[model samples]
Target: MPTALKLTTVQGNSLPIPGVESWHVTAKDPAMLVMTDFHWHSSVTVSENSTIDAALDHMKHTGVRCAFVIDGKMSAVVGMITAYDISGEKPVQHMRLTSTPRNEILVKDIMQKMADWHVANLKDIESATVAEVLKVFTDSDVTHIPVMEKNANNEQRLRGLLSFAKVKRLLVA
Candidate 1:
């Protein structure tokens, strides 16, 4: 048998901890308020072939309004899908156009293709303020903005994403 492990008992009922400093985000704050930085957080993703219902379920379970749709090999994002896309008129349009049943509709069928996405350069976003980001959101009437950066290979890679809902929740201006 191995040696017995030692366990320490509590020496006091209370421990001292530093108090958190409170701060409110303002329109002049860093654009990070509107962005989900991929470096610190994972993006919600779903297979392109997944049924719209399944994709919507995954988004609901993850508490995210948008997700990147990855291709079969899961090596590339071919499109984007949002809660609106899954629940909005896109589904009905696709069904009518393709004569497919609602249950058989796939994320790729209603998703906005990568080529159609309006994106922001990571470099531009790095220096942008919350107010500027909000302006882009309002002017473009877009709910999501995918941030891109060039990797060492000189190929553009998805870096982060900006969400209008997130910005609205954190915006003080």
Candidate 2:
């Protein structure tokens, strides 16, 4: 008759291997998983000629929360402003749409200056892991991160944008 193999128990379960230790391994998805193959272009942009009211109107029409202030020269990415910046404090009755035109109020007049904003270049973003992105979101006040890339001419171009919402979803997923 064949001999029966002996079994060992741990926490009321039989061990797969007798006299060998068992371990539980936890795995995490890397930052690459969060990156999408199809880039979602952020069309929310305005020129220096654009007024606060016009920008706000454009934002409302497009359902975008923020607008990027752009100029033809070098794509400096001067600044960005949101609807909350305008309406957060002012009451609805006090908010002026028609009376206060956009041309009259240049984007620079209302945009949160670059000096006051936190900037993260594309290289910086590419090097940053999902955990680092989460740390940035938790540590900073800004919601959007501008992703910059170098063009064929070797000039920096604004490639895309990263939002806190996307980062959070990726981390949790």
Predicted model with the maximum TM-score = 1
Tell me which residue pairs clash in candidate 1. none
Q: Give the per-residue Cα lDDT of candidate 1 at 116.
A: 95
Shift in Å, residue 29, candidate 1? 0.4
Best by the lDDT measure: 1
The lDDT values for all models are 0.91, 0.62
Deviation in Å, model 1, residue 91 alpha carbon = 0.4
Candidate 1, residue 82: Cα displacement in angstroms equals: 0.2
- Candidate 1: regions farther than 4 A off: 1-24
lDDT of candidate 2 over 1-173, digit per residue (tens): 99899897658656467634532211144443343312564457777567667778888998666777877573657777777655553323233643544346655666776667665666666666777766777898777666667778998666666566656644543
